[model samples]
Target: MKKMLIVFLIFAFSLSAKEVPSSGEMMFDLIPIRPLGLAALAIGSGFFVLSIPIGLLSADPRQTLEQSARRLVIYPLHFTFQRPVGEFYGYMEEIEYVSD
Candidate 1:
């Protein structure tokens, strides 16, 4: 019991003796103006507010793809197509396919 107490005291004293800076030394001498940080926060908040209406106004993927193809392309990509036989599942699972 005494041996354990002596070991604990020695360990505690050794830890406390390590060089720890005073609060004055650890504190920043010059604080940042942070204009950029404030600007970023403002812009992010604006975008968050903007996204709520934009998301509601956004068209469905199938309709958007169809419209884009009709307005500006030789062929339009369709999202409602099925997979070709013997193709790997992972290879084409997430791609938008166009009928040629």
Candidate 2:
């Protein structure tokens, strides 16, 4: 029974997982998610500015500031502008900035 339950759970999870976005998801992302992300970006930028002095006081000031900026500003910017339309996978993952 346990084995069957586990197998059923795995099958159900796999079937419900969406790797590709449908047209409806694309439309929803464009119409609503993007705008909300933009708003969040703006708010986060403001908070980032306010955190600068406090961040500077940290032992590892540079790392602290960079982390704050990445979380508050960069992630939102990526979600709002850089991310592909309707791709929600990046939302839950850590974003790393790769410099060329």
Candidate 3:
């Protein structure tokens, strides 16, 4: 019983001593901002829009273009959609599994 009490006191003291990373400091961590990814996403969307004109003008691989469009849209969307819930895949904040 004494050992358990001592352990509890030590644990409490350690928790008090530990400083949490500020939410602001970890803001980008949750959403991993990538300018390049955003740029590519924009370019892909632009090209997909341009392809619409080409498709209207002549023969075009509609199926292939659809696949490419999906790929392009999905990559950056992945960052937006996947980065938040790092532990679970969709929720906002990361839940700590192990506490100090």
Q: Pick the candidate with the highest TM-score.
A: 2
Q: Per-residue alpha-carbon lDDT of model 2 for 1-100, expressed as tens digits? A: 9999999999888855548888999999999999999999999999999999999999999999988998999989988998888888646485666743
How high is the CA lDDT of each candidate model? 0.42, 0.89, 0.57
After superposing candidate 3 on the true structure, give the runs of residues whose Cα lies further than 4 Å from its correct spot.
1-33, 55-60, 85-100
lDDT of 1 by residue, 2-73 (tens): 999999999888854545545443232112213333444455555545555544566675555444443233
For each candidate in turn, the TM-score is 0.31, 0.73, 0.39
What TM-score would you give candidate 1 relative to the actual structure? 0.31
Candidate 1 worst ten-residue window by lDDT: 74-83
Instruction: State the lDDT at 41 in candidate 3.
Output: 78
lDDT of 3 by residue, 1-100 (tens): 9999999999888843544556764455455555555776788788777776665655556755655566667555555444433222233234222323
> How many Å off is the CA of 77 in candidate 3?
1.8
The positional error of residue 13 in candidate 3, measured at the CA in angstroms, is 34
RMSD to true structure for each model, in Å: 22.1, 7.0, 11.2
Instruction: Name the best candidate (by lDDT).
Output: 2
Query: Distance from true position, residue 69, model 2, in Å?
Result: 0.3
Q: Residue 86 in model 1: shift from native, Å?
A: 60
